[model samples]
Target: MTDRRPLVAGNWKMNGLSAAAAELDALAKALADRPAPACDVMIAPPFTLLAPFVAAASGTPIAIGGQDCSHLEPGAHTGDIAAVMLRDIGATSVIVGHSERRQDHHETDDLVRLKAEAAHEAGLVAIVCIGETEPERDRDQTLNVVTTQLAGSVPDAATADNTIIAYEPVWAIGTGRTPTAADVATVHGTIREVLVERFGEDIGNGLRILYGGSVKPANAGELMAVANVDGALVGGASLKAADFDGIIDAYR
Candidate 1:
């Protein structure tokens, strides 16, 4: 087992505004006097709030990130923001290949791979997400599907410092239905095996693998305690200061 520090990252998704700044403020205050964990803490808000959030998190253990970014550095992609731009605005990380993008926008693994490369090229940490849907799970193809996504979405140059993997089962996200501990162990272990096979034991063992999907304060500690479950990619629970802070406390 590697000694990689755990990380609890909040995905604010499309929520938050200057008015919502209170949430982050509250979170900052809650984390202030508490002993920092052996893990890292990150929050990914929408593009519109990245700068303000980054500013608020300065001098704190909290790191701010972007939800997604365009693969191209700069272009006429109009609405699309590039990874370099996010970095320029003080974002320390970016989430790539999230299940929502894959399902809603029909994004393929190849596209996710390119975006991850863009994040790497821009010197930003990439949190690549991969998991199977409900049907895939029901059909007993969870491992196969997850492995394929892990293989295709993660780039070859991936390292512990530059990358993190979040397993967010499409079925579990926002549905309040989490897999059993044994189930989570099985998948995470398989993911570790794949990483070792592809990246060699040294780097693979050091990689951080997070479990996401309906993760809340109630279950955060239990999930974090599981072998290979280094952290979480929180969804709705991340939108509120109290809830997100609770999940962070679970790491302690």
Candidate 2:
């Protein structure tokens, strides 16, 4: 939270349609009169709306991203979009291996690794997600599961420039549940340790680690204040310009 630049990214998830474009424009216009906050902002809308959303966010501090990308650059992966394609469409980043994708699509860490590699290859920042389910948390195996996922999911080529880690408890995401500030600090600290050990001190400390799961403006400042909590990966609240803007203000 000190030297590390906070990044408040919105994961629009599967929501947002053409009309959602208005939210983007609204956000751009609303923030135009003010000085830029001491943080970064990004939004990952549904694939169908990336172009329009990016267009709407044009000239703003906001960066555009995709929810997911294919492991392969391009080929016969029907129904899948490649990282290159997303970049070609003006997306500067893409999320890979979110917990929902890991659960619904049975995406393995190896799969996530490949996808992250593809993102890096295409010059996109990969927000690689890692989290434990409710049962794992109940069993108090959160650190074990998180470390394992990080070890297996992050690409060897990953660096501060190309990768960001998000720690979202499965039980918390969209459930209005969240780990306490102390707990959040512990996990993020652990994740930071692993990152430094794997990627070296400079890159690891420089890499941003975001907290996700039911993040809202009301609780954002406290969460962002926690050690090692660089920012947030907002969910439902991100779909609304007002809510997302409020969350971004947490860094101020």
Candidate 3:
């Protein structure tokens, strides 16, 4: 991974409420007793909870991010959140092109790219997600699909400092099923190749590439150990402080 710092980010994903601040409190306490874990940590709570969660994690090492952001700047997009608004509330990063956004909302690659550009425009790191569906994986098109998404969804302005890539196979999300370590290595290796090729060695090799989908404490170590995998984008396991701490233990 060279000098790329690991980033373990929780994607709370349509989950959590103001009460969830307790979990951040607990997580903060857990980290307070130790030297910082050997990785970067962040959480993208629902929009409604961002401010509170940011407050809860204020003095801690954890960063607060948004789950999504609008491709357009502030305007009458109706229910859409601009990256600038998230930044205004102390969000340092934003997720773009998540599989759910791509599937449920039928977002095209161009739109995802625009959103990433928007994040950069607002001075936020864009965690861009890409992956193949179950059917595509079954047909052995994983590499091709990821390559295409990398080409289309990631913007030209992306740099190691402003972008992160997350690979989340749609079928495995929240299903308690995870790709084998070797499988993860293969996919991450492909992603790294595309990034290096497109952005050149310096920028690509410095960018962090994370794995998501079924990433619980039990499998976090194995997944993080995979080549080219700099960290994770955790889902269900991240909802609770204890479980999320356990996953963070992989770095500790």
Candidate 4:
């Protein structure tokens, strides 16, 4: 197995409010009793809760991040949050090119690349998400779509330390439908191959490639055991402490 460390990140997506602090607190408590976990953990709450969640996670291993950020530097982008702003508020990472953002905002691969570059400029890790929709998969274009997105969305400046590749098939996200273990392995392996070809063996192999889409505790163990599947970018289940803790137990 690769020596790359695993990372389990939660994408709260347009969800959560100040009241979600209790969930964070409970998560912290749940993790406190266990020995140091084998993987890194993070949650990307909505912009409104970033500061408070970061504060609440202090002295805990959990990290807080922003759901999305503007590609441009801080300036006249009304209703847009810049990556630097996220870092300014103690958010160590940012999610870019999520399927929701791609579909809802009509975000293109080139735009995603720019956003990831901005995250690097602000010294924040960019979780670059790439995947195919159900139709694309059904047509056998999964590899083409993901690799193209990987090439276009992930910036040239990306390295293992500053960038993460999350394969989140658009169809499976939040649908409670998951790819078969073999399917997950094949896609992740193809992704790893693409990274190695483009970024070189050392940097590519070192970068952690996470699987996202309908990931829950019941399947967390099975999914995480797949070759080249480093971790998960949980959606719905991450909203609760007990469910998230159950998923984290796979690494524990």
Judged by lDDT, which candidate is best?
4
TM-score of 1: 0.98
Assess candidate 4 and give its lDDT.
0.93
Instruction: Write the residue-wise lDDT of candidate 3 on 80-195 in tens digits.
Output: 99999999999999999999999999999999999999999999999999999999999999999999999999999889999999999999999998888999999999888888
True lDDT of residue 147, candidate 4: 90
**Can you write out model 1's per-residue Cα lDDT over 96-131, one digit (the tens) per residue?**
999999999899999999999999999999999999
Clashes of each: 0, 0, 0, 0
TM-score of each: 0.98, 0.98, 0.98, 0.98
Instruction: State the lDDT of candidate 4 residue by residue for 62-121, as single tens digits.
Output: 999888999988888899999999999999999999999999999999999999999999
lDDT (C-alpha, whole model) for all candidates: 0.91, 0.91, 0.92, 0.93
Predicted structure 3: lDDT? 0.92
3 versus 4: better lDDT goes to: 4
Writing each residue's lDDT as its tens digit, candidate 2 over 1-252 gives 257888999998989778888888878876786667788999999999988887877788999999999998688888999999999999999998899999999999999999999999999999999999999999999999999999999998888789999999999999998999999999999999998999998888988999999999899999998999988999999999999888887866
Which residue pairs in candidate 3 collide?
A: none
Clash count, candidate 2: 0
Estimate the Cα RMSD of every predicted model relative to the unseen true structure: 0.9, 1.1, 0.8, 0.8
Q: How far does residue 75 in candidate 3 sit from its true spot (Å)?
A: 1.4
